[model samples]
Target: MTCLKADLLILAGVICLSLVQRGKTKTPARVMALVMTVLMVAVAFIAVPISSMNTLTAAQDITAKLNPNKLDAEIEKIAEIKPVLLFSPKCPACKEVTEALAKLDPKGEKWQPVQSSGEAQEGVKYLKEKGYAGEVSYHRYAGGVPVLIIKQNGKITTIYGKENIIKAVTAPAK
Candidate 1:
């Protein structure tokens, strides 16, 4: 995804530079071309990989599989701050959980409902890459959502399904 953005940026910069170069007599145009060149170079250096495109794509595909432990760790971290409820917006069960949590913890203190807004894969990618601790190699999680992870009796407990989530969230803290 990032490489795709970099490639697009480079392409746009090249097009802009070419257009600017066509009018090289103007000082502003020359400056713009130089700026575009520098911008493209910087983006390439920072985002674009030096490896072959196939190699990069293959590597990305390999890394794109979600690491369950990382997902658990991320949820655990969120649970430390507040019990985390991972929900998918489009899911019916998740919707029920969301409503339950909304009514249960209006102040957002008792429960933190993290919306895994998009598809499961995208959600996992978002969580892994830009989660509570950013830049972690979290990948696509093609699993069921509405997962409630909390600390219960000194142990971290993960509850799945809408009924279990509702029960766990509503239960008195021990």
Candidate 2:
């Protein structure tokens, strides 16, 4: 039933086995049993959410920095020219793309960041404080972070991600 109770039961069983085997007077069996029990407990913890707390915390930190309202306007602006958008967060590859776009005539103004999670009010507040005025759309991608879509006329055209996002965003009209 409960995890603590289960762990205690398992630990008790291991201790009992260790003691019973020790009654005959051997040392190797006792050591092996202790090691096995420790390993089992370790595996149990690794297979659970406790091990993933760091990753979840990092994701939340990243999500906290996004301005959703600005994202909405960036999407609208991009849609006026193209139809799809490729985007990624503040990773090195995405930064490379941003740098490449910066070299273009009009740069950072065309891109937007979409936070994949967190409270909508916080996101809106962030955008307002940043003075970002745009039509924002809050939606998740199929299996990744939220992607901003820019539609030209009625067709989807630009997509943004960690890789090649700059090239996709800055390419000539097609």
Candidate 1 per-residue lDDT over residues 1-174, each given as its tens digit: 445566667667756765656444566665666676677678756454565566435433333343344455666676876677766656666666666666666555567767655654543343333222222122234444656768766578667766777777677776
lDDT per residue for candidate 2 within 80-107, as digits (tens), equals 7543333333333433443444354232
Best by TM-score: 1
Q: Could you say which candidate leads in lDDT?
A: 1
Model 1, position 90: C-alpha lDDT score: 64
lDDT of each: 0.59, 0.48
Q: Model 2 scores what on Cα lDDT?
A: 0.48
Residue 18's C-alpha lDDT in candidate 1? 59
CA displacement after TM-score superposition, residue 37 of candidate 1 (Å): 56
Deviation from native of the Cα of residue 102 in model 1, angstroms: 1.0
Query: To one decimal, what is the Cα RMSD in angstroms of model 1 from the true structure?
Result: 13.0
